[model samples]
Target: MSSIASFVRGVETLNGWVGKTVAWLALGTVLVCFATVYLRYALNTNFTWLQEAYVWQHATAIVLGGAYTMMTGGFVRVDIFYGKMAPRNRALVDLFGTLLFLFPFMAVVGWAFWRHFWSAAVVGEGSPNPGGLPAWWLLKGTLVIFVALTTLQGLAMIGRSLLVFGGREEFAGTSSH
Candidate 1:
């Protein structure tokens, strides 16, 4: 039980750190977008790499922050019922949701994205547009990261649910809901 608690804490910590760190990319995306617009409109010039940079940053931030969103309970839910459920019942819902839905979806997406990332890496894929950024494989790899982090968080959720079932809800990590 203690070990399970530790696992939950560890996964949550990792996802929290990753999510917070990647969240900075949102600011970078905005700044880059502003710069791109300024350069294009004010100076009447554009750089493909600059344009693609913001898109990459935006995508990376969103993808990598998924687990964090789950950890913090930021993902949308049909709260009309969920919000009114007892703790144990909520745990049951979370358990089944993770096992029945999240895990399977992650498995399928992970495999598909892994193949895409691998093929891109094998060929050293780059942006197709002239003057666009290089190393498109890096962008594709974010999908793999997304799948991994979300799956790990799902495991943590399962651990939390088990803790609740065992009447050790105190051992559950500080999940938002």
Candidate 2:
């Protein structure tokens, strides 16, 4: 139980740090997009690299920050059913969901990401568009990162659920969202 508690705390802290770090990419995405628009129209000039830059930033934020979103319970849910359940029942649902649905989904996606990233890295893939960004493999690698972080957060949720079911209220704290 202490080990579970420690795992939960560690995963939460990691996701929290990752969440905070990736959050800044949102601002970067907006700034770069605004600059691209401004430069294209006002300055009568266009740079493909700049155009791709904002797109890359947007993708980076979404891909890398998704685990943080999940950790924070920011994803939409069909709460009409879930919210009506008792706390223990809610924990059970989360536990089953994490095991049956979330873990399997993550595994499949993680496998696919590994294959895709490996292929891209072998070729040193870059943006297909002319004058676009290079080293697209780095962007590809974010898929694996997303899977890993999401898996860690899922494990934390599972630990929290177990704590709830075990009647460890002191450790369970609050239900995840």
Maximum-TM-score candidate: 1
Q: For residues 1-177, could you state the per-residue lDDT of candidate 2 as single tens digits?
A: 889988988888888887788789889989999998999899988999998888888888898888878877788989898888877887888889999999999999999999999999999999998989899998899999999999998898899888888887654423242
Q: Give me the runs in candidate 2 sitting further than 4 Å from their true place.
A: 170-177
Give the TM-score of each candidate. Answer: 0.96, 0.93
Candidate 2 overall Cα lDDT vs. reference? 0.85
After superposition on all C-alphas, the RMSD of every candidate to the true structure, in Å, is 1.5, 1.8
Lowest lDDT block of 10, candidate 1: 168-177
Q: Clash number for every model?
A: 0, 0
TM-score of 2: 0.93
Give the RMSD in angstroms, all C-alphas superposed, for model 1.
Answer: 1.5
